[model samples]
Target: MSESFNWHKAVTKKWDQNVAFWSEKSRSMWNEGSRSGIIPFVKRYVPVGSQMADIGCGDGYGAFLLSEAGYDVTGVDISPKMIEHANQISGDRLIFKQGDLAELPFEQHTYDGLMAINSLEWTEDPKHALDELYRVLKPGGRLCIAVLGPTAGPRQNSYRRLYGEDVICNTMMPWEFEQLASETGWRTLDGYGVFKEGVKEDVSHMPKPLQQALTFLWVFMLEKQ
Candidate 1:
């Protein structure tokens, strides 16, 4: 499915209105781990002075972390509402733009690094998005992505099922992600899931029989051809 099935006005409207939900969720996960987790992970591949692009940078949370590390960061998202929130919070540290991932508005080989955390699944076409990502990145530039796993447990599965979202939603199992990277003109340097201490908070407060799906971090530090 190209997400066209669920790409009605109502869906986009709901996604836009859910900015608070996303912002709060990101704050607890990626933002909280910026210094101790994300920065260090980024430092492993992206160096100081590098120009980076963050696709689907929800509220620019991770972009802030990357900018603090001295990278010139630009955050792009499909939601203008999300971009507005990002501009308010990110200030001048990063540039936020309302744009689509599949049809990125940028020149070729313009960046030294690109980061997409948990946002890959949101793109209308993940493979095409990756192709665009590779095009805008310079040769040897790094592409870092973290996606969800297939067996993400009941908490995640239940909500997605209820919402009628894609189960293969934005997630790609380790091996599948690796294959995606290879086919997209990237050479993988590292890959794996970094599980946090617990399950998603949404499911945390839910009832029993709902096994909290352990959040798995599936990241790949890849280099462009």
Candidate 2:
């Protein structure tokens, strides 16, 4: 299969067979990082009453948060399971749909802002996806993109390497990611390395390599040119 198809399949399988597991993990992050760190950062630039689109928005938790914050939010994901979960969790505050990130179904200039947290790394064509984002967003719309950095600590690395059995695809370094974003016409607005620390569910799975390397590195925010 093509790389893009393979990545899509991996996410599909995760949602179909392991939706609860991934949802719980994503939910945990929503409480601390997505709610407190990410949403606040995005809100700083996106004015109130703006229309926002959250691409690759698994389970729509982020979209729910943004809608609750007063943005007209539409969340889209590739996985039906994810969209279903999101619809169930979100109620009327957020709208959830299943769609491709690279070929969003929305019309041109549909939204005033966009958010793609931890979702770009899974795309086979990051540049194409960003171009679509540029098309859907209004002129000078703010975009906040967060992806799993190349150095996401030992535990995650170990889990993907061991239990995932190499099903994990690729992760880009910060500089490479920034270059791609810029080349795709996303202006670098304000960005910072966000670091998050957490232990595994079991003590036996803990790694003793804290501070051994940069863990959970992600760009905070950016904008469409």
Candidate 3:
């Protein structure tokens, strides 16, 4: 197999092994932060009753929040263990499925909006994954994505130490991320830095000097053109 495939496999295995730990941790804190940090930003662009996909939706907490907010939500993750836990909470308007970010299972133009919070950075090919997300979204649909930024710092280093050198994580500067969105046929509607309390729109696009000054997770709102 290719190096990329092996790296992805290792990442998936690591998540599978830690699903229980992550599930507990998510419920304790991460879920609450997401509700305050990203959910409201997403809701502003995607109205109720729209179909939405929560890509890389571990344990489905984010998806559940979107569902409760009135969207028909589908949560997808590569880890079967995560999907299994997610399915426990699934219902009429919420569906959880095991799937890869680079190859989403849905048909073209299937969703009105999609969110891939903290997930794309782990993909072997972020550009390919972005393309896949673009394909599945209906024309003019919105996408909200969050990924590790330059500020990932020690947390990222610790992952390499724990998961081995082959583990994949690709972080980009704010301008690079904006350019990627433009190249992939998505127009940047808004972008921000996500904090534990809420989202900040200050870091959307930055010069190299300013980019170097900021060290935080990035959340972007993009629209298909």
Candidate 4:
């Protein structure tokens, strides 16, 4: 992260400007084939009727899906415009709020499960963000976090090109993230990678090298211990 970078201002501006594009993209993906892998993983791991938080939930489509699956879901994002768009579609079991990931607005032990999909990679302080997530989760709460890994070269470059050097796309290595999780009182259940092209594959069972070579995103399932 750059010393002079204003993460909140920069991220907020970017998302506000692109919220319309993203809202449509999210809707299309949710309705089409993009969420096939994620939905299954969520169904298998997160029990029905659990209180869940979708951190960095842009446009709230993922939260909508989780609510449909019987989770009482709260979608949180830093972008006010994104939250506004999400609220327009909110229902009985789903709501959207504007909040920073490093300093979530909820009280302690508030959620039974949480997800941070494609979100943490842009955080200025991911460790603090993870700490906040740990603080809000009840004991044994499940967390499904997907982040951009180092291999997402094109995506990283795009951010730099569009935003400038100060706007960083911080990709984490698997081992680094695993260590952070361990230190933050989380027990890892599984770790895997998914490709950027939306291909449905079970690369979690493959070796680390092979997985890294093939995928751009890393997904981790963990339990708060």
Each model's TM-score?
0.79, 0.80, 0.84, 0.87
lDDT string for model 3 (94-121, tens) is: 9999999988999999999999987877
Report the C-alpha lDDT of model 2 over 1-225, residue by residue, as the tens digit. 334446666656665665687678776777765335777778899997888988988877778888888888889988888888888874455788888876899999999999987666666677787788889998888998876654575225325544535443446666677788778777878765544446333432334233212446555467777
Summarize candidate 4's per-residue lDDT along 1-225 as a digit string, tens digits: 567768788878888887888887787656664344676687678888899999999989888988988889999999999998888885789989999887899999999999888777667788988989999999998899886665666355336644446754556766678889998899989766767665578767777867866666677889999
Whole-model lDDT for model 1 versus the true structure? 0.71
Give the 10-residue window scoring lowest on summed lDDT in candidate 4: 154-163
Best candidate according to TM-score: 4
Ranking by TM-score: 4, 3, 2, 1
Q: Which portions of model 3 miss their true places by more than 4 Å?
A: 1-5, 28-31, 153-165, 195-213
Q: Which residue runs of candidate 2 sit more than 4 Å off their true CA positions?
A: 1-7, 33-35, 153-168, 196-215
Per-model lDDT: 0.71, 0.72, 0.79, 0.81
* Tens-digit per-residue lDDT, 1-225, candidate 1: 444565434335555887999788776676465223756777888888899988878778878878878889999887888888898865455899987777888999999999887767665567987899889999999988876654444125325645655443454566666788888778988654555555435544543223213345556688997
Cα error of candidate 2 at position 14, Å: 3.0
- Pairs that collide in candidate 2 are 118-146
Model 1 lDDT at residue 60: 81
Instruction: Count residue pairs with overlapping backbones in model 1.
Output: 3
